[model samples]
Target: MNSILRITVCAYLLSGCTFANSEAMPYKSWRLGFSAPNYMEVWIESADVVDIKEQVYPRAMSGTAAIQTPLNNTGDPRGWPEKPGIGKGKNVTGADLPKKIYVRWQSLVEPQTYQMVINVPESTRAIMRKEEKAFCAFDGKWITDYRNALVINLAPGGMAKIWVMGSCLPAIEVTKVKAVVDPRGPYEGKSGGKYDKLSDQSKAYVEKFGVPYDSWK
Candidate 1:
């Protein structure tokens, strides 16, 4: 009788007219774990962007969740039944590992010649090229442990999106995807002026591509 009463009370408490989805709340930023000295960081802007960000974790979930069990019948000690994880251990959260940074390589003027060194699978290079790419500190670093990558150049004022991929479930393996923009062709340096002000021509490009005029300029 006591057990029945406890279950009934629990059910009553849980039965509600509505429940809030914490994820649906407006999130300005999300924190993800990276190995010390090699952590990844990303800042989110809108709800639609958040939804896309959410997809990365699920892709890495299994890799993070699979913990190794002791052999020789010591009895399977899977923490997951008691405590589910976004990846390998009980501590893991639904955060994507080896974070990705996507930027809009909008053009400020009529598209000009540009160079990039994106770390993408050969398959994704064409899509990346169509988008404007930018220079990054770690672009084109040889990846000893990955397969399939490509690099390409794009037009001036064009845009390219780039990001990394990985899983940190077991503390075992992590991965990353790369798309980089390298400076190629001739680039002339101009002196400081009212550079903050966007040219009328560049402003239209920024509006059309949803990128910041100043950043692209």
Candidate 2:
């Protein structure tokens, strides 16, 4: 090939490699896990988002009293499952990992959805990439050996945390959201339109665990 043609071919090959790296996550499975004191739901807000659900274990089964599973489009009440998780898990492909997620849950007030950014610092990702089969300093109960994962954790009252396998990053309290309203559930109390406030009962739970994994608000 001529010098110009050789340069063109090398550039094309380099671009292809970059595309592959972005499309495939460095993990067996990437999970979208959320929890709360009550019911909640999480969905990918980004278009062309990757979903490799078949790669995740313990998929949702019909008629299982477990009530919460990845297939439920939800999170069961009272927090993360006794198992690894009760939310969505997939072997994402076709695009770069997303930087945000959507969380929906009903509190004393009607359910609202928040579109919040997921901030995973490079240092955190590096720790997860080299992580051994150990525990997450954040999600203590889960003893999973995740080498590298993109796990989103949505706490109640718009508080968000994330799990990158072995690391659970700090909380990102979300004050602004779309379609928020007043509390009117059976546990009805005045929210004054600020959805970030916890209900009377849920407040107690917060002190015990820094996790909002809450009424799923």
Candidate 3:
């Protein structure tokens, strides 16, 4: 009778384990924080594109047309992890940066969407177009990849305050701006490498046994 009871208990526990593992996991969303704005009712992102880019230069020479291409070094579809071309600029020594402050919204959905609201100074607003691309330079160099540019179209003026909203996270702010154009995606660079393969569960086996705990009378 004791042996039969032990077998019944083992079956019950195994069924519970299978049921728990079969349930699907729920999806969750998160919001990453940036600097706060000085004003309220600032229009946030309703929808926008998240662009990424990278450099693809096979070789570099001392005197020749500098080659630049959109590419990524990492094999992951997310785009290149680093942009090396932007570091070739004169270093700044405690330079005061212009205040073009804004807040970028980072919500993780299926495709992962982003939106930003930037308050451009009145002086730079007059020239701001309906669709403008601004090169996002970080630290010192022009970010050539995932650290690419933020495509924002601001109202142009000398001192008129305008709110610029768009999709995609902004480049690291400390980096200054150099050029402007439409934002692009990560460049698909070299593609000739093998990736790690996943293992099959069928090839592995586990020992199955029965053990009894005795506390019942």
lDDT of each: 0.23, 0.35, 0.20
Q: Which of the numbered candidates is closest to the native, going by highest TM-score?
A: 2
- Relative to the unseen true structure, what is the C-alpha lDDT of residue 140 in candidate 1, on a scale of 0 to 100? 48
Instruction: Please give the lDDT score for candidate 1.
Output: 0.23
Better of 1 and 2 by lDDT: 2
Q: Per-residue CA lDDT of candidate 3, range 45-140, in tens?
A: 221111011111111101111112222211111211132122111211121111222222211111111222232232332222123343544444
Deviating ranges (above 4 Å) for candidate 2: 1-29, 34-37, 41-86, 95-109, 131-145, 166-217
In Å, residue 160's CA in model 3 sits off its true spot by 21
Q: Write the per-residue lDDT of candidate 1 for residues 71-184, one digit (tens) a residue.
A: 332322211122222221121134321112222121223322222222223233222223222333356443222111111111233333222111211111122322233233
Angstrom error at residue 15, model 3: 65
Root-mean-square deviation per candidate: 23.2, 14.2, 27.2
- Tell me each candidate's TM-score: 0.17, 0.38, 0.16
Query: What are the per-residue Cα lDDT tens digits for candidate 2 across 90-144?
Result: 4443323433232223332224433332333444434544535554565665554
Error of 3 at 206 (Å): 31
Runs off by more than 4 Å, candidate 1: 1-101, 106-144, 147-154, 157-217
Q: How many backbone clashes does candidate 3 have?
A: 21
Best of the two (1, 2) by TM-score: 2
How does model 3 fare in lDDT? 0.20
